[model samples]
Target: MDLIKTDQYGRQIGYVQGANIDFEVGADEADSINDFEIELKRWNWDGSIRYGTRVFSPDTEYGGIVREISTDTSTNVIRAKGDTWRGMMTKKIIQPLSGQDYATASGELNSIIKSKIEAEYPGLFYGVTADTGVTVNNYQFDRYCTLHAGLVKMLKSVGYRLDIRYQEGDVGMAGYVKVSAVPINDLSSEYELTNDNNMNFITDDNRRGINHLICLGKGDLKDRLVIHLYADQNGTISQTQQYFKGAEEIAAIYDSSGSERDDLIKNGIKELESKKSSMSYNMTMTKLEGNIDLGDIVGGKDYLTGISMKKPIGRKIWTISSGKEKVVYKLEGET
Candidate 1:
C-alpha cells in the first residue's frame, strides 16, 4: 500500500513512513536496509540540530498537520462595500473679504457701482454717453459728494446710465447738486443727495464757464485770469451747461485751428483752474455710521487742506452784508 498522510481534500500535508519502510522491515534484521534510517537523517540534516540544538522538538503532535478545508469561510475576496472603500466629502468656509489689507469701503462702493452698471447694461458697457453735466458746475465738496462726482464722471466716460440731476434756485443753481454713497445692500444708512432744481444769480456777459468756475477766477484779463479764487460752494452754475460733441470733435477743432481756439480753450482752462482751487470737503461714509474708517481721511489740495471734520459740517452760512437779511440756505449733503 502506498502510505502517505493527506486531508479529506486529497492534498498531502506530510508524508507517512518512507515508501520502503515496510519493505525494509520485512528484510533481514542485520542488513535491514540501514540506508532508510540514514536517508531520513540526511533529510532532517539542519545546521541547528548539528550544533546540539533540537530544531523541531514539539510538545505534542498537531493532528498530523491538518488541512481541514479551513471551515473558516473567512473573507479573502474584497467586497464593493469593504472597510477599505470609504466615501469622502469636504466643506470649506471661504471669506469674501479676506487677505486684502488695503481694501477701503469707498473703494468697495466704487466697485459696487460699476458692477451694477455692467450687469444692468451688457453691450453698452463702454463709449461716451452724453455729457451728463459739466463737472465744474456740479462739483461736490463733501466726501460722499466728491466720491459720487468722481464715480459719475467715470461711469459717464464709459457709457453707463447715470442720469445726473440739475436744478436752479433763487440764488443761482441752488439744489443743483447730487451726492451719495454707492448703494450697498448691506448698509441701510447711506448718504445720498439727488436734487434737480434751480437757483438765481447774476447772468454775466461772458458765457465761457460756470459761475463757480468764474468765481474761482478772481478777475478777467485780456486773454487769461489775473488772480484765482476759491470755488468751494457746490451748485450747478449756468455757463458750463452744454457738452462738446466729443473728444474727437475737440481734437478736430484743435487740429483745424492750432492757435485759433486758444482764446476759448485758454479762457476755459483758467476758469477750471479757479474752480479746482475752491475748497474741498470730505466725509466718512461707512456701514457703521458711528465709526468712520480713519484711513480714508487724507489731506488733499486746494480744498480744506486737511481731513474734513470726523462729523458732518453744517451748511456754510454766508451774509452779503452786516445788516443783510439772514437767509438760511442749507446746502444738502454737507459733510
Candidate 2:
C-alpha cells in the first residue's frame, strides 16, 4: 500500500507507487484501509500556507485613493491605499470660506453675508458684527430686547427697522439672550436670535456662572434694582461688580452718631441702629466668598483683589469692614 495526497478539489494531485502490488484504495472504502500513515512533501502544488499576491490595476478597482497594489492570493483581499482623504466619501467638508478645515461652519456663512453686504452696501455695514442682548429665561425668541445704544443708532441710520426677537434678561453668562429680527425688503428677513431668551428678574441656579450686578439703585435709593451684567461673548472678560451705597443714608447715620455722642446711652442706641444696615461703598466683588477681595479701597490706592465676604450665621448678613467702618454687603445672600 502507498500513501496518496489530494488537493482541495478532491482530484488526485499526487501519489506514490510501491514495487509490490498490494491494494488500491477507493474513495468510498474508509473502514478497510488502515496501514498507511501519510506524510506530505513539498512537491504538491496545491497552494502555499503563506499566500502570495498579485498586483491590481487602478482602472479595475473602485474605492478611495485607488492605486495599483497587491492582493492576497489565498483570501483574495486587496490592500488599502493609505490616502489622506479616506473618510471623505461620507464626511466631506466643502465650503467657500476662510480659516481652518474643521472650524465652525457657521463662521464661514457669517463671513459670506458680511462680505456680500459690504460689497453691495459699501460703507454701510462697516463694523457689523455679532451683537448680543439680554432677556429672561431660555425660550424661543420674543421675551426681551436689548440693544447697545450705539448699535441701535447705527442700524437706524441704515434705514433698517429692527425689533428684538429675544434676549438674555439677567445679562449674565447663564442668563437668556434677547433675539432681534429686521425686514430686509426684497431680501430675506434678518432673523437673529440668542439662546438666553427668558425673564431674568430672579437668579437661576443654571446661571450662577454669570457675573451680574445687583443694582441697588444709584446712591442706595429705596428701590434697589438688580441688573444682570453680561459682557459680550467676544468681548473682554470683566469678572467683578462695583458696589456703591447711597450717600444720603451714610451721611444721616454719621450725623446721628456724631450729634448724640454727648448722651452715651443715646449715642449707643443710635450707633446700633446705624449699624443695622451693612456698610456700603464702591467696592468690587471678585469671587464668591467674602475672604476674596477684588477692588481698590474707596479713597485709597490699596488694591483689594480676591476678597469675598462670608455671611454671618443665622442671618443673611455678610459683613466686611476695616477699623470699625464696614464696607461691602453680600447682596447675593439677600437676593
Highest lDDT scorer: 1
Worst 10 residues of 2 by lDDT: 19-28
* TM agreement with the true structure for every prediction: 0.17, 0.12
Scored against the true structure, residue 210 in model 2 reaches a CA lDDT of 24
Give the alpha carbon lDDT tens digit for every residue of 1-335 in model 1.
12233333223334333211211110111212111111122333222112111111011101111111111125321111100000000011112245643222232333444443334334222223323332222222223222223343443333332222112123221121121222112111242311111221111122232333322222234543332122222422234434332331111111112233345446545545543323333322112223221111111122222222112211222112222322222222332
The sequence of per-residue lDDT tens digits that candidate 2 reaches over residues 1-335 is 12222222222333332111111111111122201111122332223111111111111111112122334556443332221111111122223235533221122222323443344324312223453332112111111211122222233333332222111122222111121323223210121111122211222212112222222222234433323232222222222324322331121122222222234334433343433323222222222222221111111112223222222111111111221211222222222
lDDT of each: 0.24, 0.23
Instruction: Give all candidate RMSDs, comma-separated.
Output: 41.0, 33.2
lDDT of 2 at 145: 18
Task: Report backbone clashes per prediction.
Answer: 16, 35
lDDT of 2 at 306: 23
